[model samples]
Target: MFQRALICTDFTDSMYRLAQFVPSLAGGGFKSLVFFHNVSVESGREIPREDPELLEKPRQRLQALLREVPSNIDVTIDVQMGRASESILRLAKQHQSDVIFLGTPTRTMLEEKLFGSTTARLAEKTGTPLMILRPQLVSTYTTAELELRCNHLFRYLLVPYDGSDGGKTLIKKIHHQVKTNPNSVLERVRLLWVIDENVRRELLGDNPMEQAQQELDKLQSELAALNLVVNTTIVEGSPIEEILKTAEMHDVGAIAACSRSIGGILKWSAPSLTREILRGSWHPVLFFPN
Candidate 1:
């Protein structure tokens, strides 16, 4: 669903490894790629000053990773000393990026609140989509494996569709994306709806399963109209667990999700399916923020 991409990496997260795979990323459909890194300003000094030298090493390291740039692809490197979130937002805008890539390790909600998460914060702040990878997974992938992964990153997406307004909005956005980019690398989409037998059984009334199938079939047609191969699933079980299980079974590249809006997401209490997926999924997540 993205073409112009802003890839942000903290060396520790292993996201910079993508710099070596520009050709693979291009194969995944990104035409313009900007790799960004932010160096935190050193503190504790009576008079703090930004150091130009701090940015040079990161720039060189990223540059060193690129062997050959494709003639059809535009690639750039940006390194600066600043707050990561602010710099990422600025660079994303400057690059006109449709997506920003980051690596976020799984952490407890308590840990997330105490330590903070740049990925989560960015979701709340930017309209640009985020592709979040697990640091542990990225750290372990062999170069060959990573390259293959980059090539198919958006080819197949596993989307959880609850048929809520937010779910409808997410589908609409996906349609818009594919409609605008006739050559969008996104070829197949799997829509999943897991009925919570415990909670939603009442809301869905006597024929929840029938109702879900009808909704999914409608969504399938909307996506299939774009010539996308669309598949739909409806099961009665835990939403998050079923979604993850289906994603793995289908070998999906990413789990595509969206919040109604940043403000609406901020108001969601604990144990939201979206939040749980964001926190627990080892697979890459494509998050479309409002």
Candidate 2:
């Protein structure tokens, strides 16, 4: 669904490889692509004073990479010295990017807390949607696999819904995008509701199973009107476990989710389901900020 995408990479993330498949992404509806890279300054330096030769190396590398892109599609390469997240947001705004793509690596909990992921920080700051890809998985994809990934990135999506405010917002955003973009690759969607078994059994009284099914059915009908193949399922278990399992079983390209804002100090301390999914899932995740 994204026509103009701003892809942020560190080069180590292997996202630079996407330049080779620009034609395939164009086939999937992307008309413009901007590849962005930021070089971090020294810890104690207020401003970057690196050798001009050093800075020029990355710019030259990006130019070499862009040569593989097909001439028909619009492309831009940016190599700058700055904080990654800030530079990415600034470039996205300047370019009016429809979506931002980022590559995240698997991190231990300690590493996540100490290092503070750029993807997490960007998600908190930006209103734009993010397509989070796992670098380890993407870097290993064969040419054929990469082609498929580019051409069918959003062909099918698995949505985790629980009738919450975030869930409703996610549905509304999807509806709006589909209506506005007729050439979107989204052909099918699967809505999954996981009943948290840890909650008090009494809280789920009076046929909770049936009630969940009814909620999903209503959502299905609403999305089906957009000329999409919509399906719904309700499962009882841990929300994370069930959602991941359902995604694996369904063969979806990505998991579409909405992030709930956590304000105050809790924003820094509390764990988020959206972040958890983004960190844990090998599959791509389309995160819409609330």
Give the TM-scores of the predictions, in the order they appear.
0.95, 0.93
Give the runs in model 2 whose Cα sits over 4 Å from its true position.
49-52, 67-72, 262-271
Candidate 1 lDDT, 144-216, residue by residue in tens: 9999999999999998998787788788888888889865999899999988867854677788889889889
Q: Please, what's the RMSD in Å of model 2?
A: 2.0
For candidate 2, the per-residue lDDT at 214 reads 91
Summed backbone clashes in each candidate are 0, 0
Clashing pairs in 1: none
Give the Cα RMSD of candidate 1: 1.9
lDDT of 2 by residue, 203-242 (tens): 8878888998998988888889988999998989999898
What local lDDT does model 1 show for residue 1? 68
